[model samples]
Target: MQSDKPSFVFTGWHMLAAMLLFFGTIITVNFTMAYLATSTWSGLVVKNTYIASQEFNGKAAGIRAMLSTGIKGTLAVKDDSIRYGLAMPGDKPVLADKVTAHFKRPVGEHQDFVTELEPAGAGVYEASRQVLPGNWIVEIIAVKDGETIMHEANRIAVTGEGK
Candidate 1:
């Protein structure tokens, strides 16, 4: 008994189409990811690697010395105001002649700014500046009698609602 309907067959063209679709999807995804990565971040940590390497040990030693003092810092961002405070091991206020903060974006320097904080109280410093909500790398420096007492870097996320 011969039926009128004919069975379908998978031919070379079908195989070629399958391979093309598979490879095309993969290539498209790769190109999109590469473009996004290059466009977002410049991937630059330092201008000169050799100079940074040479100073690494000295910076490490300075950080160790700074930590030995058992000084702690606090940062508060509210609306357009930035506040910083320093305390000793026993929670005593650390008085400093000058306090400055360097705020930088993690991926770019376009939004970076340095502001000197005014003394609000014993160990409290405050600055009125508008910082956009995003990730920030803050470097706080406190100097007393022209000598650095505290030098610390901290990473913080600023949300839409300042707190």
Candidate 2:
């Protein structure tokens, strides 16, 4: 004898609903990710790719020449003070007339600023500035006699403590 209760059956409508739900969820997620990716970052590293490519070899040679000078640089950020130091192999100070530090955010240029560090001592330069808490890309250039003697780039993370 059969029971009075009706049994469940899988029909075309159920299949259609399931397929729609699966595809709809995937499409929704894809659209969301695409929007976020495009809206958040511009993904531009240089203003002109062709010009940058043309100058790449010269920049590489300049970097090699700078490295051969055996000058080492150190950067420190603490309590609204940004300090940079340059030294040789035996801790001897490097002779440079001017030093500049270009601070920029990795994703945007709104917070970018260039600070000309004044000489505090032998091969030491410093500036008093409050860096925001986030990721930064810093490019340091040391000029001596109208020529760049040392050029370096570094990535740093600033925390709430400014370290």
Candidate 3:
């Protein structure tokens, strides 16, 4: 006669070791990811605000130069907000009274995205302009201490929900 019982393939010691290893790895990875994520988020928020503040004119001017070359650069649309950047060269950045973006609608009407920006530092000025869905032409003008220094233009395409 033979009696049947479930076999214990893994001993308690082995199970405990495996569980410790697995949970340790999981916790380590989670902590590392959280740290990276927090750092990145803070950096982005500060950058955006700096750009919007119009403080870094030199940096911002350089960005304008890059975009005017008809090459796609740092401008992007995020959740109904248009984010663009520029860099100017000098000891300081210029704050502008107004930056006007001139574009033509697909139907041939003209539109403008305009704003005044605050200075962020290192010659970078940042601002945001509301934009509609369609093709766009972009231009920026900078005036600092009552002097105009840079102006350039480019084209872009905008697409998303409600554009």
Candidate 4:
């Protein structure tokens, strides 16, 4: 007499089911990662890539000319403002005709901001605005005689430790 228990057998149907489950899992994981990555991603900075590429050399030349001038500067982030301190070849502090600060987030463009830093004093420019505490790429520009006399960029972290 044979027992009523059915013998379990590996067959084509089992193989097909396993393959579907494996492929389905991979597809689901790939989609999930793609979704999470785009939330804070930022694309190209240049509006027109072709134009930017064509004018890249000219822009570099202008920046080089600006750096040739013996000027130095420092930027500090404050609770209510960003301070820019500049100096010429001499130890004396000097203020350019126009000064601006461009702040951009490392990961995304949503929090990026650009504003002219007002004259605080001799060789000092300040922009009064609260900045979110995190990573930032700062570009400081000083314009003199209708030309950019200096351009400087630096990466910094703003921790709300003191605040």
TM-score of each: 0.82, 0.86, 0.39, 0.86
Worst 10 residues of 2 by lDDT: 154-163
Q: Residues 1-163, candidate 1, lDDT per residue (tens digit)?
A: 9999989989999999999999999999999999999888889988999999999999899889989999999999889999999999788999999999999999867789999999999799999998899899999999999989999889999999654
69-141 per-residue lDDT for model 2 (tens digits): 8999999987899999999999999878999999989886788999999999988999999998899999999
Instruction: Give me the runs in candidate 4 sitting further than 4 Å from their true place.
Output: 1-8, 161-163
What Cα-based lDDT does every candidate model obtain? 0.93, 0.92, 0.56, 0.86
- Compute the lDDT for candidate 3: 0.56
Residue by residue across 86-137, what tens digits does model 3's lDDT show?
4443323333454434444433333544555444453444445456666776
Check candidate 4 and list the clashing pairs: none
Over 1-163, each residue of candidate 4 has an lDDT whose tens digit, in order, gives 9999999999999999999999999999999988878765846688899999999999999877777877889888978788999988766787689998999988888789998998888889998888889899999888878877778999999989412
Worst 10 residues of 3 by lDDT: 87-96
User: How big is the RMSD of model 3?
Assistant: 15.7
- Comparison by lDDT, 1 against 3, better one: 1
- State, as a TM-score between 0 and 1, how close model 1 is to the true structure: 0.82
Compute the lDDT of residue 80 as modeled in candidate 1: 90
